[model samples]
Target: MSLLLLVDDPARPDVVGLRSLSDDGTLLDSSEVPTDALPAVARERADRPRWVWDDTARRYPPLLAAGVRVERCHDLRLCHAILRRSVYTQSSALAQAPPGPWDGPRDPAPVEGSLFDDVGPAAVADPLEELQLQLAAVAGSDEPGRLRLLLAAESTGALIAAEMHHGGMPWSVETHDALLTDLLGPRRKGGRPAKLEALADEVRTALGQPALNLDSQPDLLRGLRSAGCDVESTRTWEIKALEHPVRDPLLAYKKLSRLLSANGWAWMEAWVHDGRFRPEYVPGGVVTGRWATSGGGALQLPASIRGAVRADPGWKLVVADAAQLEPRVLAAMSGDGAMAAAGRQADLYQGVVDAGIVETRSEAKYAMLGAIYGATTGPSAVLMPRLTTAYPRAVALVEAAARAGERGDVVSTWLGRTSPRPDAAWQAELAAASAEGAGADDVRAARRRGRDWGRFTRNFVVQGTAAEWALCWMAALRRRLLAVDGRPHLVFFLHDEVMVHSPAAVAESVAVAVHESAVEAGRLLFGETPVDFALDVVVADSYDQAK
Candidate 1:
């Protein structure tokens, strides 16, 4: 008979086809082994039997063949190691090994460091901590039910601030201080000519009382001006001044002749209370490394809100915007002659059409945009072929990059911000499929999946480059705002807009700063690549009024 060697774990409940050694050390199948002796093999107490191949028998040998392999000896440590590596490598099948002898102890944790070691605790109050405190205070109040409503209001205000800041205003302590001073108004050196005194003659003439003194009505006029209602207007001011108060609640109508006109004071008081003069911010709001607002519509500030964003006494707000950012970034990345040429000219989409890439400019625009953005469905997919034919270099570059991504490699932004790679399971699946039969549909599908991964990889480069441009723009604008000695502080930011609270005096200068910053940001990002970033800016007393 041929000698057969078998290595099996009796302790394993799934052990089948296993045999035992007889009393004289002769191997026998489970059927031939005595039933009472089964416990010895099953309990793994008896010495495990091993079969050796007998070459002279001229029959099937059972020792490990040329390629066939199995563990020759029981090694709990080695088995656990194999299992761990299999798990780490994300192998399709688990290691054919037994469990560890016992559960392992916990790993040691890393030590924590103080914030001062990194950013220095001497820095300004932590924005996150401040926000947490504010939130806690609001949440812990007697009216806890109002927390959501309060948060919503706060978020709206933050959005407004972000939009305003995005306009290209600088956010700094000095600018904020200056803006606060302007909003509060400057103190007069000498006793200023009271508004009542200035309008004393007009009041007397309109009221038909030549000798009437109106020294007590200056607050009313100041309040009217603060509400944005012109105190000198004839329709509201003069007409109202002429009407005498028929009854005075405090005087019980006994001094109707002495009572002054309420005029627009009531409306002004209400306006001041309702209008947003200042908004709050929550700096670290976005999970994807972006800022978020706690108050104000930072993401969607209305033009009317700009009217409420007045600058400080002598400072002004500046704003800027980046132009055709992503397309230019794509042109640089792909090095597509047609795309480069399109970018060189004013309109990139038109250039693609002019190059005969597409029948119409709209199609060219959509296709080009979709290509850079990794769009693969519907209309975007339909236009891909034309794009590929027209700019093979660009197509190939992104396609190759995407392939790399599918292979579980990390993709980098233009500035070297690398995306996290796919996990081990993904790598194992791709690797395993790559080794499978050629021409098989499964293999083809795996290759296609890899290509799809590459597309994502390619788009990341362009998108990341665009994001860098935005950051550069923000940084440049921040620097420019700092250069202006006393301008409106940047109180908000959106993707491409900035908002500043500044005085009317420096509004024009702030706008200029914003424009210059955009040009500078472009130069810094692309290094004089005939591309330009232009902005449209408007300045007013309030956020709503800015255009």
Candidate 2:
């Protein structure tokens, strides 16, 4: 594909600059065009050039709003971040270069109008230079092929995020309001809901403190202690362990309180607009490579209000989530054919039971999670050895990652997303543990911190690889959907699940495409790997009814 580098002039809001780059990233030509004519310029191009822009959120939304979608693009900021920290590209000029304008977050608010009108703070990073550096970094990397694949998938993910924002999550105001009313009892202008107030009263009476402030943790804890209850904190789980009489009402209060605060009437009023929830998704937001949303709580939408995610008339929501994604990725990464076989015929846990690795599915789950998460106590720890003994290849991979992390070394995911070095505080703890004057307490603390970080890296490798798989899945699924009729498009994406809004007539075909795309994604990541990325596909009018 040809390359078009977009250059926005902050000083002149009416026109924007564009440059064409050669295959080797050499600038071939430059031109300026009217800002409002961008859509026509893009639409008239027979080449359908891959857009090279400083930030996707800033540049892509307006084109999408104008009804023009590009097939591919290189996102400078996202790729720069990857190459800057990536171990594979450390020797390249890009990684060795000092921190510059591209080192921080891109402007938070995306440009929804003329791109130049919202051009932020006089573009400090030159797109042409940045693209040259990124290309050089990838070409010189240890695993050029893997890094290229990763960069492409990462860029595609950015486009998807922008597209999803433009095409917002389907939301129903009536259903949302009704759910709030049914659960919390009526909206209030400046007061708590009736049910919540009733619960608070019950809590106060049970605690024997009429003036208790349940909202304040210290106040609630002091009130509990004052009422002759032995409580350390106001955490619901800790409260659940208490045998005191106030336990029931207090737990109920906390549960209802969370519902009221997170997805309450106020939240709905702010997030839901024009029958859609348009969250600003921050792609590659988490270090482990999972996505995070900057707004609308897209990742943390609680079950209580999912009913509001209803399909529009003549359309259906196609929801599909992978089953045991991390473990499946782990098996493929480790080349553990036995572990893969265990999940071949049934749910992975049930397959583990049938294979006699563990007596029950619960034990299988705990043991598998423990192995991946570095669990050192409780049932997970106790069951881990048996699992390790049965699945040596898989367990060894994570165990090796843990040991590497304990030594403060960086570990990479299957596709080479390297972890950061241990922080200064962690280094200090290690030094203190080994210094001549170190005491038993110092050594014990260091040991604990080492294990904690070890657990993090152990999970990071599998989890990060799983995230890569998911991005690949969405990229593949998006391509498949683009070919289908009725404009099936992805509207919501959690870590391992995707929700597509499609015309009701093509919902079944969309589901099939979803399954095919999962297979394609698995192939793209681990070619011909036997591990299954099985999905639970559903077609529903409302998200809450999918399960």
Candidate 3:
């Protein structure tokens, strides 16, 4: 049984409508409650029904704030996005139907104040109609079970996101402050850090322009040019190659400047609260089904400040990351036995080296990444033939997707997240390239454009599937940890790495759960495929130790 919840207004609800439905779509109960009493109602039932909501982002936060936790939910907005675009379920009427409010931006402007401060009207009715459509689409898809799994995993991710936000990532404000001070010098009120200011002085002195403002790109570029340095951009790599006294200082200034702007004292004040950094994570935010952070730069946490991520007094942080996840996913998806055999090793790249396919591990990595990312030249391109010969099936899978993309065709992941087709402008360019009077340069430009989009699609299939595997991994680990004693909870999650805050006594249990969950995730994604998704797991006091 699942309880369908309908929201009339996101900011506040005058009444909360709940409809209980059986698996066969029969409505068992229908009732309404005031916004304040809804949590109590939800918690009254021991075997809580799976809450079906239009958007989890809006509803779950308030519930979590009220000390209520939902075990399962069917997020309609997420499922609708998947069903409408997925090629596997396109035959269903829901997929074929024209866009409506359901297809709009899944998240509205975030609620600003108290969760239930703004009282609004009751919802008109249950959103069973939308839920029914999603259910039908999944049941009628080409791979019903797999499509169902994708939806389930995606919704679980939403629940996890909310829960993780409620139990914010453990952060040490003191440590972070100390690190900032050490790296950037003492904080100044309404002024740049001491170290950054000093570097700026070095930059200006090197360029022989005391009045130069390093913050302004145009001014910096002009200063560089006037200093007898031939440079077109202020990019770090471009700056590094130049033979100028300004080069080193300018580079140092840029690095520290970025650090100051992105995660400086102001960032800490705005984001970190109660010794926790609660980044707003948006699941399925990326087109490849990857998670994205709407705030706090969660996805882009730099290694420089990671030492600040410390555990509590009696707890340990179980940090774990999938080893060679994407390549292993490629091997399993392509069913390349030889590639899977290589994945069995602790270091897949070194295994490739041991196989005599590449002289060094670096070459093995370049060739594999080159194959997936579409390297047309350089060392990657030079090593491509050998890698392709070594793992023919894996290389062929990406090539097939690339060719499909070149023809403006869409490709689907293992669980059916499809690549979007080329837009109108691209189509026009491709047509012009093939036209009878196409110039040599025009042909070359069009070829380059095709290959660029081709690279995106080539990487999409593997990357998207790898993301699905990650979601499943997290889901399994979440469930396993929930059943164990000691309140082990996931505190942080990047793409392939997750941190679990656990009692020191149960840290061993958390580590074991993480290892077992990796196996379970692989099994769930590619059953019996001769692939091992190895993990580098460590029970550490801080995150850096695991790395």
Candidate 4:
């Protein structure tokens, strides 16, 4: 007897609609509610209804602001993306239907200082019809249970992304400013940092080009070559290998420059406000199911400024991340007993050594990573045989996926997310290379492209599945945290790590919730199969301290 409540706005700051449905997509009731009364109406039915909305970020924010929170939702946009690409639902009517307005690119979710603000909401016109279409598609899938779980987890991720943005990550402006001043010297009104300018001076002098602009790559490269440096590129790795006076200071200058440009004073001013950092997150933006941030560097928070992620007074930050996520996912998906056993310990690499797979932990790690990622050179290739012999099932799984990729076939994640088919240009290359009079160069080019695709597929299966596991982990954690006695809210989520902003009194409970949710995630994904997904949880005053 689940209730499906379809929500849509008829006009901005005015009329909104709420249509209720029974379990089988049958319309049970319909009502028009004013925007101002939405919170009260939503709160009354929040406990029993599954809120169906076009977009969570757009619809849920105002409800959250008005002190109303719904327990579950079916975000049509997020779930539509899942079903569209899912292999299990490829033959469904929803998959074969003509593209509609829903196929348009999503406007990036709003952040505090975003230029692209969300327009006032208007009626979607057919929220009930869209939900029914989605239901039919889910029913048509071969693995309905699996696809349902995937959709649920994905929608939960959407909700969490919005909620985390609304709550914001606790930040300390004073600490952030102090650290910036100490490293780069005082903030400049219309110029570069003091320390950065000095390093730039050394880089130019060493290259023997007094007026060289370090910011311009071509100018800097030409200067280096003219001064007897055999560098082909100005990239950091290439620069590091060169034996020249400009190497050290140039590297220092680049590091400091990135820090100054990326997260310096201006960044703080734009992103951090009211003692919190609010960034707009785009869930499932990456083809591999990873999240992409629209602004504020949420995914790439530099380690130098982690101390600014301080908890509020009388509160603590519980930070935790999965240990060796991809490899563990590989073992579970492949059902490799040896590989799974090797992950029994906290450090999977060390466990491989203990299982006699390699002589050193480093070798074990290199070999396993090489196996899944299709590496064929360096230490990876040197140690590949030992890894393959030790864990044939795991190696064979990726090998099969690679072979499928070489044949231009599709591959699916552990759930149902499918790898996109080769594009028109790529297929043309393959066809032209197979034609009767094709030249050696054409054949070689096609082979190279095929191998590249193979490598992509080999890694895609593992990485994408790991992302699904992460969503599940976060979903379970969210539920447990909400159910706990004291209020503890999720503040930040990277792919594998999460930070909870909770009162110090509930910090221990939050840690327990973290461990329990991880266990629940493993159960939900792999069932009783005994592959461990270990997490390192710490309670501290700041993110850096927790680490």
Candidate 5:
């Protein structure tokens, strides 16, 4: 049995229209509950009925606040986004339905306030109708099972996102401040850190410019050139090549500047509270289904600052990262037995070297990246023929996707998340270049655009599917952790890595769950493929120790 939670306008937070739904979408029973009592109702049905709703982020937070947790949910907004663009359902009648308010992206999450504030609900205007349409689309798809799995994984991600927010990532401001102080000196008023200022002074002295502003790119470039160093930009890579007095100092300055700007004292005040780091996660935010963070730099946790990510007292942080996720996904997706065999080892790149695919580990990495990313020049291109000969299926799969992209055709991942079609402006430019009597410049421009899109789609198929694999991995881990005895829950997730905060006693159990989740994610997405998604799981007292 499942419950269809027809949420009312959030402004009237007290009201909710609930419908009991059978597995076949049949209405079994219906009732109403004040938003406050809804948690009691949810607790009554905990982990039993799948809660159907407009959006999980909007609805689940309130329930979680009242100490209620749902077992499962079907998020209509997320499903709509998938079904609308899926190639598997493009020809379905559900896709042909006239567009309505449900077609637009949901309004942003509400701000913190009283439930009785009456700010109006952000609920979808027609969730029941949207649910029916999504069901029809899935039922009519050629690969219904794949789409179903994708939706299930996506919805579970929504639940995880909300729960992770409610239970924020454990952070130690003292640890972070100490690390910052050790490396950057004590905080100063309205200016750069002491070490950064020292480095800037060194940069100026090295360039023989007493008053040049190191903060300005143009000023730095002019200063470097005036100092007799030939340089186009002040980028680290560009400056690293020049053998001059300013090289080392300038590079050091840039590194320190990044830390100051990204995770400085101001960042600490804004993102951290009550010894926790709360970042707003936007699930399905990226076109390829990867989560995008709205704040707190959750996706860009610098290694230098990771010491701040300490576990609670009597707890441990079990960190796990997939060794070579994307390449293994490519192997599984393309059914490349050779590549899969290479992935069967702990280090896929080393495994490739062992199999004689390439002479060196570096060569193996570059060649495979070249194949998936459509690199047609330089060392990657030099190594292409070898990869094509060695892993023909994998190379061919990406090449076919690239060719389709060049022709402005859409491509999809294994579970059917399709690449968006080229926009109208691009199509017009392509058409004008191909029209009768086009100029060489026009043709060249069109060709460049085509190749660019080709590269995008070339990587899109693998990256998008890799993101799907990650979602499945996290979703499965969430369920497994829930079934555990103690306080073990996922605290942070970054692409192929996840951190679970657990009691010290259950840290080993959490590590086992992490490994099993990786295996389960692979099976869910690729069935019984030979490709192995190996994870490096580390249980430690602090995040930095996980390395």
Candidate 6:
């Protein structure tokens, strides 16, 4: 049934079942003999387990001699499988076991009403208290104006609630009043402005009016403008909803509404640290040096979330975005004079057409993009031959890099970020296939793969460079904000969007700083590239209505 080998060294002959070798190099069950007889037996066997006499054990004239060692083949796969099975069995048993006292605390009783069911009265009241505490702390700080601005930001939250209520959505009256007070209150060293009562009166003026909320009606916009607020559009972009068939669009809408509600809760929680909502700023989060969201989903905020950003008593947010950033980046990298010149004028794609690179602006745009990205198929494929003929140097560089990568070499970004190389297994597979009568077609496919890899490597250089530009922009903006003596602090940042809280007096200055920072960022990144990174700005009383 089983086999066991035995061996003993002649130097110590007092061990049991000691033998040098076994017949056929396989040791089966053998006779148990006296300790002194072990060495003699082991010397006759072909393969045996080794044994040494244990002098430390005094009793071992020995019933069974010790110091025997078993040796077997070492295979990780077999070992892993054995361990995995044991773990699975244990986990399954644990899962079936009765719940312990420490499993979790009991859930609270569910509330009445659909909107208020999950959220309790305490939940509705806590945010207002939190805002009060935040304002109190900020007011007591050296920068009193900073606290006022934070309070102003809190008002935007009120606007969101008001908008919801105006749409006939359910909300508690206490919560609504709390939000309104936070919004209309004076945000300065002094208490609420004498005109604040008037402002509050104006806000309440729309309370019973149908379609006066920020979303359904543009009344809030008019009100803010009437109140001397300056508002403009920042950036306009379309969001294409994902296509998924649903039984009821209304149900889907409700689900989305609930999701936004949950997102709001999370956003407020993460943002309200230190009595103010200050989210983290991740510089160079994207490959293009644009900012990334670390928390509160600032960049990925839904349309509803935008309604909550508002200008402080005297401050406005100056928002801007680069127009056609990627194409400009491509032009700069390729050093195509015509493309660069066209970008400098108005449209880089049109510039290509003017240079006779293509018949139309659209074709030039696609073909040039395809070339940079190493797209040699589809519509891009049709233009490849023409692109190569027109811009051989530019095309060759990316193509050659792609070829190198397909050949199993690592590629690096402009800033020295290297792509990982193929592992030994991959190399071995390729080598084996090449040896097995792999024809020209096989070789050509390999080269094509390499070329694509090179294209990725080449683009990484450009994209990474762009990312650096964005970091410089943010850092410059932060520095400018800090340089100003007033207390309007930078609070939130999405890729290209920055929110600042400031007193009404210095809001325009803060806007100026934001604008100057953009210019400085451009200079820092491209030096004197003869191109501008223009930003569109918007200032509003509420985040959603800013545009």
Which candidate number maximizes TM-score? 2
lDDT of 5 by residue, 438-495 (tens): 9999999999999999998998899999989999999999989988878699999988
After TM-score superposition, the amount by which residue 402's alpha carbon in candidate 3 deviates from its true location, in angstroms, is 0.6
**Clashes (N, CA, C under 3 Å) per candidate:** 56, 0, 1, 0, 4, 29
Model 3 residue runs over 4 Å out of place are: 1-3, 7-12, 109-126
**Model 5: ten consecutive residues of lowest lDDT:** 110-119
lDDT of 2 by residue, 1-547 (tens): 7899999787998998999998779989999999999988998999978899998888899999999997888899888878887889999999887667777567774222211121224436778899999999888889888888888898999999999999999999999999989988998778889998898999899888888999998899899988887778888788898888789988887987898888888788898899999998988888877888777788888898899999999999999989999889999999998999986853888889999989998999999999999989999999988988889999999999999899888899878888877889999999889999899999999988898899989998999999999999999999999899989999999999999999999999999999999999899889999898889999999999885
Error of 1 at 268 (Å): 21
lDDT per residue as tens, model 6, 1-547: 1223233335555544422222222333444456655434444546533222111012121222332211211111111111111212223322233432212211222112111111212211121222222323333443344223222222222222122112211112333223433433322333333234343334435333333343222564454344443543111111012121211322333334344344434335445432333333333233222344344455565554454455544455555455555556555555655455656645666766787778987788788778667776887779778777766655665666566666777543322223445557656655755786888776666555556556666565455445444444555655576567675555555444555555666667877887787677566545666555555555555555555
> Which structure is stronger by TM-score: 4 or 5?
4
TM-score of each prediction:
0.44, 0.96, 0.95, 0.95, 0.94, 0.46
lDDT of 6: 0.44
Query: What would the TM-score be for candidate 2 when compared with the true structure?
Result: 0.96
| Model 4, position 361: C-alpha lDDT score | 87
lDDT of each: 0.45, 0.88, 0.86, 0.85, 0.86, 0.44
- Comparing 1 with 3 on TM-score, the higher-scoring candidate is 3
Residue pairs with backbone overlap in model 5: 9-121, 10-121, 11-120, 11-121
Per-residue lDDT of 151-262 in model 3, one digit per residue for the tens? 9899999999988888998899999999899989999999888998999999889888999988999999999999988889889999999988888888888988898889
Better of 3 and 6 by TM-score: 3
Clashing pairs in 3: 14-120
Between prediction 5 and prediction 6, which has the larger lDDT? 5
lDDT of 4 at 207: 81
Question: In candidate 2, where is summed lDDT lowest over 10 consecutive residues?
Answer: 111-120
Deviation (Å) of 263 in candidate 4? 0.5
Report the candidate with higher lDDT, 3 versus 4.
3
Candidate 3: residue 378 Cα off by (Å): 1.1
